[model samples]
Target: MRHVDPAGTGRAGAQAQPDDHPLPTPGTLPDTSVTDPAVNHHVNPRTDDLAVNPGTDPAVNPGANPGMNPERSSGTNSGVGRAVNPALNPAVDPDMNEVVGRDDLLLVTLDTLRYDVAAELAAQGRLPNLARHLPGGVWERRHAPGSFTYASHQAMFAGFLPTPATPGPHPRLFAARFAGSESTAAGTWVFDTPDLVGGLAKAGYHTACIGGVGFFNRRGALGSVLPGLFAESHWEPGFGVTSPTSFEEQVRRAEQVVAALPAGRRLFLFVNVSALHQPNWFHLPGATKEAGDSRETHAAALEYVDRHIGRLFAAASARRRCFAVVCSDHGTAYGDDGFTGHRIGHEAVWTVPYAHFFLDHGEPTT
Candidate 1:
C-alpha cells in the first residue's frame, strides 16, 4: 500500500521495421547535450543577415559581445525566432488522437489495503515494476463510496465514488448514469445502470470480471448482484476466504483470460483480490495458525499479495492490450481507536489505497 503524487498527468505492427525515429533507448542514460538535428534544427535568417553585415567587425562580434549572437548586433533585436517543425511534435499529429483513443484500459481492486501500508510498500520497492510504470500515479487518500464491499462495490459499478473529504462546491456524478434513470440513444445512462461494466459493454467494449469475494461468486440470487454486469465472469473452486492460494490462482486465471481473448477487439477486465482481506495469518511462511494478530502478520500478507500483483502487471504488459486499476474496496481496522476489524467507522477502516496504471499508453488527459 504505497501512495505517490498524481502529477500532470502502443502497439502494433508486426513485420514493420523498428521505428527509425530517434527515441531514447530504454536502459540507457540519455545524453543531455545531444540534440536530434531533425527535431532541433534552428535557422534565423534575420540573425544571419545581421551577422554578415560588413559594418560589424567579425572579431568583435564573436569575442567582444558575449551575450549577443554573432550574426546580430547588441542594440538591435530580430523578430524572427526558431519554430519547431510540426512533424517532430507528436502533440500536433492528427493520428495521435486516434492512437490515444485505441489503447486499452486496466482496472484492479486491492480488496482491503490501507493508505499508510500502500505508501510504505511502494516506497520500499515492494512494487518496483508498478513504481517504474507509474512514477507519480498513486492517490492514497481517496474516500470509498461505502464502508464495506457490497455497498461500496454497488457504488463503484454505478460510478459513485465516496465523496472526498475535502470536496468542492460542484456536485460530481460518480457513475456514468444515475440509478433508475433512462439511457440516451448514445448508450450513456442518465442514472446508474448496473455498473460501469454494463456501460462499457454498451459502448462496444467486451467486459470481463474475475471475482474473489463471495458476494460476487454468483452462487445464489446474491451472486447476481454484480457478476451479471460483465459479459464473462469466473469464480473458481478454492477461491473463497478459507483458501490460501486464492489471489495467486485468480491472477493465473486472469492471465489465461487475456491470452484467450479474440484479437483486435476492445476489452475491459476487472478483478477483485481477496488475500489481504482478513485472517491474514496464513500469509506468512512459517507462522503457525496460532500466530496472534500483529502488524508483522499483516506485512507478510501484504508482501505475498504484492508478489502476485506484480505478476498480474507483468502478464498485462506481455499482452500489450490491458490497463490496470489497483485499489481497495474498503479498509480494515486493526484495533486502532479501540476498533478491532472493518465494517466500522474508524479512520483505518475508511481510508484505503487506490491507484490506476495504463500499459503501453501515455498519461491520461482531461
Candidate 2:
C-alpha cells in the first residue's frame, strides 16, 4: 500500500471579456513570512480553523509521527524530506485579506506530480511556464494532506494545506466553520460553512471550476461531489486523465471564461490538470498504461501541461491583479519497493512542489 502524508502541518474563477489591463509587475511583493508563532500559538476554540492533529485527524487518518516514515526519512539521510517549520516560515504570497476582493484568485492543482521530477525539470529549464515565479516566489517541498486526489483536494478546499515540517505548528489561512477549529491566523479567512465556495461567495468573488479527471467530472453520483463545491463547474471527455489533449481543451475553456467576465468583478478560478494522472503512455511511445506511470512519463506530461498553463497565464496577464496557487495534490509511486501507485504509504507519493505568486497590472500599493 502507498503511504500517504501523515496529517501534518501543511497548511478560482470567472469568465467573460478580460479588461485591457496588462499584468503589472508589482515593484516587489511583501514577504509572506507569517507573524511570530508565539502570537498565533494560543489556540482559540472560537476561531474557524480546524484543530485536529495530523496523525489523529479523522479527516486525514494517517500516522502522526513523520519520523517513522521509513522510506524517506532515516537518521543518516537528513536532507531528503525536512519540513519547513511554519512557525518561522513567512507566507509565500499575500494573505486572503490582501487579495480576496482586490485581486482575482487562480487555484491550480497539478495532479500526480512528484517533487523530485518537477524540481529536476524546472532545473533543466523545461518548465518556462512555471519558471516565471522562481525569482520572486517559493518552490518548496510541501507534504500532501492525502495520497490521492479526492482525499487531498478535500483538505485543500477546506484550507488545511500541506505543512512545512520545521517543528512548530502553522496556523491555517482559511478554514471551514464546521470543524470548530481555533488555529486560524490573524487576517485569515474563516468560512462560516463547510464549503469554501460558500465563503468565497460571501466575499463577492465569482467562483468557477474546470474539472480535469473523473473525480471532478460531475458525470455520476460520486463524481459530482468535488465539483459541486463551486457555483459553476465544467468537464468534458477530452479532459480525462489520459486524454492527450486534456490540457489544451482545458485551456480553451479557461480562455473563454476569462474573456467573458465583466470588468471589476473578481474571480475565484479552480483547475485540476489531469493529464499526468495515469494511463499516460501516450507521452512515451512504447510505455504501457499498466506500467507506464513513471518519473519519465510524469516529466513529459508536466512539460505538456506547462505549455498549456502558459495560455492561462496569458489570459490572467490581462487582469488588474491576480494571485495564484500552483501545487500538486500528491505524488505517485512508480514501483518504488513495489509500490506502484498512490493512496497508502510512500515518500514519493506524499512530497510535492508548492508555489505562490502574484501578478499585477498596476503599480504597487503602499
Candidate 3:
C-alpha cells in the first residue's frame, strides 16, 4: 500500500549518487562492468479438479516425459507445488515439461507501456525483436493488477500478473496456495511460498532483480521492498527512468549476469525496463523536453528497447532454454480524458500489453 509518484522525476536515481557513479550519456556505449547499485490472472467458477481432454493431457501425450507425473509435472523447480493439471491450462503447452524448469526464467516489465502503443508498434514492425517472441506475433491486451508501478509490481511478484482482457477464468501460469482461488488450473505452477520470488528460490533457482524506475531504486523502505525479495538485486544511475539509454544499460547488465550465474543452476531474472517510463522524449530524434512525452515518444521508447532486447533474450537462452514474460506494469495517460499520468482510474492507465514465449537452447542470436 505504499504510495508512489507516478511521474518519475529528478530524484528517480536517488540511491545512486552521481558523484560515485556518473550516469551514462545517451550515445555512450553501455558499461557492462558497472557495479550493482542497490537493490496473471483469470477468473472462473471451476473447482481445483478439472476434466482435461485425455488426448491432449501430458499423461497421454507421447512427447511428454514418460517418468514425469502429470499432476506434479509443472516443469518448475523441485521446491514448487505440483500443478493441478497441465491439460486444463491452455497457457501451459503440452510439451511444457520438455522445457519448463529445464530453462531459465526471465520476466521483463516494460514499465508504463500501453497496450495500443505496443500493439501498433508490433504491427508496424517497430518491435521486431520482441514481436518474434510474442505468442501470436502481437502483444495481448490485459488489465493491470494495479494502476501504478509499486502497486502493479507488488501484485505481480505475488503472482497477480495482468489478467487477459477476456472474461472467465484465464488460467494462471503461476500461483500461490489460497482458498477461494478459482484461477488456479491444473497447469498453474502452485508455489508454497507467499511470493513467486521466494517460491523459485526454494526450488533452487538463483533469483536476481535488475531494477528500473524510481520504485526499484532502493532509496527508501518502500523502494527496497520489491527488490529485497530476490537473492540478488541491482540498480544504477543509468538504469533509472530518467536515462535515455536505460534499456541498453539494462540489457548489457542482463548479458553479464546471465553469463556469470553458476553453471548447471537455473536462473530467475527479472528486469524492469525504464525506457518506456516518462521523460522518454529522448527516444525521439531532435525531440526536446518541451515535447512533454506523448504516445509517439512512448512508441519510440519501445523501438529503442526492441533494438537491444534480442541480445538479452539471446544471452539468457544461450546455454539452457529460457522462458520469458514480457509485459507492462500498467499503461500511462497522455492527456486521455484530461488525465496526464497514472495512479488514477482511467482506460489508458488500466490497459497494458502482455506476452510470454520461449527461447530454445543455442548460442546467442546475434
Clashes of 1: 24
Q: Which residue pairs of candidate 3 clash?
A: 40-161, 43-169, 85-186, 85-187
* Global CA lDDT computed for model 2: 0.64
lDDT per residue for candidate 1 within 1-366, as digits (tens), equals: 011112200011223224422567898854222111221111111111112222232222322211122222221212212211223222211121122224444667777777677767777777654455543744546677777888888877775544444653212222343323221111112222455665544434446677877776666768645766665566755555557888788878677666755444455678887777776778777777776545556666677776666667665555443545567778877778778777877787778776544555223211
Compose the digit string of candidate 3's lDDT tens values, residues 109-136. Answer: 9999999999998998888788878877
Give the TM-score (vs. native) of candidate 1.
0.63
Q: Which residues of candidate 2, in runs, are more than 4 Å off?
A: 1-93, 135-138, 177-182, 285-291, 362-366
**Please, what are the lDDT tens digits per residue for candidate 2 over residues 1-366?**
011112311111122123422445698643221211221111111221233234432224422321122321222212222222223233453445445556677888999888888888888888877876654423678889999999999999888777654554555555554333444443355555676665665555556688897898765658867876765566777778869899898878777667756565556788899988986767766778677567798888988887768677666646666777788999898888888889977889999888877765642221
Q: How many backbone clashes does candidate 3 have?
A: 4
Taken over the whole model, the C-alpha lDDT of each candidate is 0.53, 0.64, 0.71
lDDT of 2 at 109: 91
For model 1, the stretches where C-alpha displacement exceeds 4 angstroms are 1-101, 137-139, 162-165, 169-174, 178-194, 317-321, 361-366
For model 3, give the 10-residue run with minimal summed lDDT.
Answer: 40-49
Better of 1 and 3 by lDDT: 3
